[model samples]
Target: MSALDSWHPDSKDLANLAKERLSQKEAQYILDHCKECRECADKLFETIRSQPIVGERRLVKKQNWMRAATLTFFLAAAILATHWFLEDNSRSGQFAIEPKSLPDLSETIYAEEPSTWFEDAFTHAMVSPDGSKMLHVDSLGVSLVDLSSGEDLRAELLLDFDQVMAATFDGNGRIARFANRRRDMGWFLESGENLRSTAIPLDAVPVWAPGNRDVVWIRPPGNRIVLGEPPDDRWHNIGDRVLGLAWDPTGAAAYGLAMSENGSASVLRVRPLGGEVEIIREGLDASALPNGLAVAPDGQSLFISLATEDEPDADARHETRVNRDLDIYELEIKSGALRLISNIEGDDFWPWVAGDYLYWTHNEYDASVMLIPLGNPGAKPLFDVVGERDGRFATQLPRWNPSGELLAYTVGSWRLADWGLNLDTEVVAIGSDGDRGPPAALVTGYHADYTPSWSPDGRWLAYRSRRSPRPVPYYAGPDVTDDIFLRRADDPDAEEIRLTDFGWEVGDPNWSTDGSRLLFDSWDRVPGVSKPWVATIDPEHGDLLDVVPLKLPDEISGSVSGVYSPVSDDVLFIERLNPETQRLWVMLAAGEVEKVIDFTSYTRGGAAWTPDGESIVYSALVGEKMQLFLVPRVGGEPQQLTAEPVNVLHAQISPDGLWIAATRLSQKKEIRRLPLR
Candidate 1:
């Protein structure tokens, strides 16, 4: 279609415009029409999104380091997260970074990692109140170091204090750490030359008070305040998610913000002596995230940051979801008056109140701390972590010393190589036979792309991708979400067309034998339960008809992925008995339980049926490596495929047995530090 009939551009012409294949005159003519025609404008953008995003994606691997995919693509790799496996899931909590809200980092010096400076940095470092000493934990174990003289004062390797959640110094500069044990989690404090442990909840960071009473703290994964001291420890139900807690100057009571069941919060006052829980303010609109706290130096007001619930994102596929970032606010302690302090574009939380400035870290593509005039919105950035120049390093987790004299944070070389938890992943095609050689990148971009299922005829492919409008770094938040996308299986650099936008995690994508429908599992509307979802599509035009979960026989709750058999009417899937228990089961055509395979699988990219439907192929962690395993339809001991030391994820053999299209991960990481200023 040209400018003769309805003056609309077809998909072919739109592709040329997106790839800059059209001449200046021809392109200008189409642009002039698109400005007036809403349909054509939308088509042009859709075509652009379909093209291969080589600008920020890498298509190759290196023996050690990555070489850029495009000449202009500075970041070739970063992210490989065995570090976040299972317990440290990147998608466990819900947090989102709006792509529109993020600034393009290639043009700026933010989000890039300065891994070089932190190649061998310690994982945890805590500064004392006077800044005279610091408590650090490394492979050698927990040790106290004198920052000035560079002297190792003491070492506590047997204690295993590396994973301290929150450590605060008492008036005597003693550190309280979570004591990791088998039975329960507790806290241990350094009393004189001896270590004393308490039964207080490990997460509730105790504030050392007089009479050996450590009061004030909220329990994690819940909304309860742990008060009193040993023997008579009291757990008070706040009935709200506590955001920030700050102690008054007199230390008589602690003031904190606790978000309610709905999208509102209240300011609370807890007196340790009388166990009095008072609500200073209630029904204040806010988002239950980004915990923050700050008491003015003069003890006049309390500072906090919150995202109001009313400002939901319009373009979001998830309905009734707020997309606003956190902003700072000030509350007068005595008068109970609350006022907005800073309403910036990004997240501003965990405030620090100095003499004339209020310091808080701003969350965006760039990691920065801002210092604004006392209770003022107008502020200037005091320190900025710029690492994109080399794309090898990143710095974050900045904390102020007790005296507010120095800022302490860590720089990491721990680039997940774009293949870890929260990291970017690309759909790569590998040959089943070793003769077919190395894998080739397809549908490359700066988002998490995985779970590829080739069409029956091998003309098209269906996969799940967390493709966002924003440029995702090594770690995209859980709320970023995975959507279904279709691409040409033969064409490695083909345009990718999105199918579904449910705004939650999608998994185990499978293309039907007839290539008419795409089936995958989702945890969208149903949080814990994993239901198989199906969508009909047009292979040529990539038109999505509708998406709905397939109702199978029996209660197959919390299923992993369901794969259709080529020969019979059987579906293979993994059943989740609990968080750690995964059992393999097959359902026949009439919804009959075939056989429960004893093989336990914690598979990723999902299991695939062989071309003949006789054997099942899946990836499993064997000796710390994700290796491919083959199991028979009848069940028994599964056969192992490859034993390569590297990660081999999402492996599936082609129908012709010529190629094995699978995914793998490579990564590097370390830690270091930077000055506050």
Candidate 2:
């Protein structure tokens, strides 16, 4: 390199070699060829002086060539040094790109190590099968962890990704499955197969079958129980609009839960793959259970938990109807008999089977995870918790290991636990060891993070984040929008990528049938002024593509709502009808627009398509309260998804298309989930 720049590696090596091979004087002579070339320089100068005798053009050309070569060497050296330094800075926790957004979410989430806010706000997490691997899906991507060792397994499985919504473990837990904004499902194993994915049809969500025999996935006609069969075109709809399916190795028959327009919950028993729809229990008043049916091993009994109106709350912030109570019932599928189990007087939901015991989480006065013994009429407290009765943290979901030996749950922002009042939500694990360890902080930061979904592989997790404590404005109006984030399941390192930063506010992001993309609605503005824009997002990179424009602005300002098309790359959007009512419209990837069937009168705010992509599911305000509706995507009269009008909103379809998980309004704004079946 020239004197203007640093030394070149080749030059340094040459000098060192000379020093090692020659005597000091000789080495100096060899290395300092330029400095010692005064005679040669003089000869060159004399030649240049005689350039007039030679040619001006020749002399100028030679000088230019020498200068060009020297400059090139120096420039190359500078570039190499800079690249090396940058790489080192990134590894040392110093390099960062000043993102486009003001008050970048990325900076705040990864601002510190073992960050208090991000750590505690873990809304979702996926634990691997052997219980060794764990994955945390956040803005950054999917974080893998070795749970047995409590160490980060990989820095990231996906890069620059956001909206990791759901994750699970396969049979052995060696492979982890995930679903993101795209509603696509992905599987990853430790071997060579990475990013092995089976796209859940845009119409249905796929859930793992018992013992990994097949996956209970959704399609147009009904629910499909797909075996461990490699993904192909084979999908069977066992029934018309089959909502929920549960398998108990102890039971001779599998049970399904369904809801009808008559405000009745029906329990159906059938064989594993394809069988007769035998109604075990019918016409049970109250809607479907939040958590699906739980069957005992002996097949003699079944437990179904459902929600109902309790009493009025005078202290409620909103001027609305009174609260309701949730009840758990034990029924004899064969004898057509039933008896009440809990009826916990509050919001009861999330039922799971653990050995001979039945477990569930409910919100009576507050959130609590309760347990009941199938063999014993009365059982002492297996576990109980009190959580925030307001905000996203108010309604909570508890998770249980497949073995049922370990029970895991979350405490919301306002939760009052034995360990003081939790200002942020915390994820805690309880082993059968009777030893309840300290709460493991999941997500933390300036926002309220909740609604965690675990992947099948147990190697990754997905969740959503909400900006909490209200905004303390530094600017006049908000410039950037709220998005999703991610973290490592084992390590303290967390990174957040932007999912939505458009001018409009986006909410209720759902993963596509596959894990690669996310579906969400971009609300134009506040209610009464804006339309919902249906948008598709890249979960790994937070890049959003406007799939459906609600109004189809002539040049600049249209709106849309809903998410991905039930079957194709197309999207479902709600178009405004002269600002009075909203209608369903389908926007294909090719930019083709077609109006579908009407959902209901003045349908706004919330909408979704059934798992099979054949039916359009949505929530509409009927009279005073909002009711659920399911209509054919091709065009048809809308069918009610919910019977009673209890102000239901923010509803989402599970991968299996068996249940509708949503936040329902009861007493204290409880979160309730029910079977679509």
Candidate 3:
């Protein structure tokens, strides 16, 4: 056995011996070594004859079949798996940042013919109540549209970097709001005003009531429900940011959904406006009710849409298809009774209730809107215009008008999805079943776009735009700039206007409380060097040229990620102490730098301020892996949110601030959420 184990074909001198015809010198050397080494000599000869020769009938039959069998098995396996092994190994190879190719078109030409360089990757959209205006926000800026004609109204700068937050329309469809930093909210009302705003003793994300009367907001720790006031202070918190939150039609009650450590569904807490006696519902998995409450006209019961991940798939390749259906539930506020209304599948998310209809989106490989009648037996498909409503390579974020008669959604694309494809995005109108038609292409770009918010009246829409980076060589590499834009929803005769030209890159545009102003930030150029700069724009003129650079410390540019306050319009960004040690910093809407709080010392970048603007959630590198960390903006220790070894990048705050959605790396890239405590 030892001799057989020791035998290796490479060790054989048989080739030399055959070539030299058993030369005396070589033969002598082999014999000498063999005499001293019993294993090599015993196994060498036997292993050689195992080839099953038919010619040269020399009567020498050597024997080590064990070694030959073992070697042959391994070789066969290697050959059989060669293609698979090569493909697998090839995917594992290091990914490098290659230089980007810059488009040769002039910036003006690109401005006039937006899609000349960008294909429609617009992902999310919002339409005004009157259906005249619409908005789209993306990696670029805020875009307003005139729905009557496919014309750009205004393109305003929203963020200086990538936006990871969801945009929602106010109940009246008159204002559009998005989460900025903690305690901050960006809102745009009917007046087309742009502002970075917040209320005193700020709340979490500001969610509007179904009637658009009061904004349902969150207050941390002791999650309290406050009524919406002027400067906007109706804040509430549901403990964890990952919890599900929903508002009743009357804006009277707020529901919180959670899953316990045991994987059992739990109704963490429920708060009714004005009267505060928290209600708890237990015995459930995770609920799909992020802003899920839509009160019945009688006010006797609450209708909510609930969803839960069924179970892990048997095959890992099918993981993307894991969370499929939504279990629509009806819950009674006074009796604490719960009943399943219907079992609907196809990735139902962010359901909006309008009159007798429950409107929600179903992502079946492709995401589209569907309306189900509460009084009827079935649901109706509003449109199959995903590619036309969205873009060729699209991601969906839809918002409906107060009446639910009209709907608007945002669309954007991934880098790989549009790698070689040409596309465009449109804010479509679906009056009823089979009424879907080609959407009004509001924004155009060579790269990607998203984030659509509609006014309460459905007459106006606000959106953001981002041009893909065009590489210009620098230091043996290349530089890229992703720009921001905005347009009007109603003025289809108008053209989109470029917002920020600083070139540091921009994203995530939000409207102020009254919609008279828009607030967003700009990221400075340089990989480990960036800073947030706030700007003001004239929504009607689509003038982004009035940007006034926000003041910051010299170190602000050392390393930063762009962001803004969801409530107050304050510009929020992350500053780093080198590539690690990220700090959450905020600037007032007036271009004044305020506080700089050291959040996490993680050896990584990328931080998102929670909807409330009290704490910032960021990504941290743990060991050789990256995870999510939540740090207070007031300066405190950081809390690790995720324990996975996978890398989490570009984390986004949900509209209600209960969930931290992020891009997770698996076999391919996937979006996941982490609950905040």
Write one digit per residue (lDDT tens) for candidate 3, span 1-677: 55434543244374443222344555445544543454544444443445332343233323534333333332233222232333353322121101110011001100111110122222224445454544644335456656456577543323421332444557665544443544454443333444434352333555666666656555443344445655645344433333445565566665555433222444443343344436555554333223344444445554444443233111211111133244445566556676543343223333334333333332223333322221123443123334323332333444343344444544432222112112234555554442555665654444344545443344445555444444111101123334555566667666666666656545445455445444445554554344444456554554664655556655366334455555676656666564245666676666566555653333333566665777777666666455667767666667776665344444545444434434342211111111101
- Higher-scoring candidate on lDDT, 2 or 3: 3
Better of 2 and 3 by TM-score: 3
Residue-level lDDT of model 2, residues 403-487, one tens digit each, is 3333334444222110111223345554443334455555554433444433222333344454423331111112324444433
lDDT of 1 by residue, 316-375 (tens): 211111234556666666676665545544444555433333444443322211121111
Worst lDDT 10-window in candidate 3: 101-110
Evaluated at residue 151, the lDDT of candidate 1 is 76
Per candidate, the number of residue pairs that clash is 21, 88, 153
Question: How well does candidate 2 score on lDDT at residue 358?
Answer: 45
Model 1 misplaced stretches (Cα beyond 4 Å): 1-441, 444-447, 471-481, 487-497, 567-569, 601-605, 621-627, 642-649, 658-677
The candidates, ranked best first by TM-score, are: 1, 3, 2
lDDT of 1: 0.51
Clashes of 1: 21
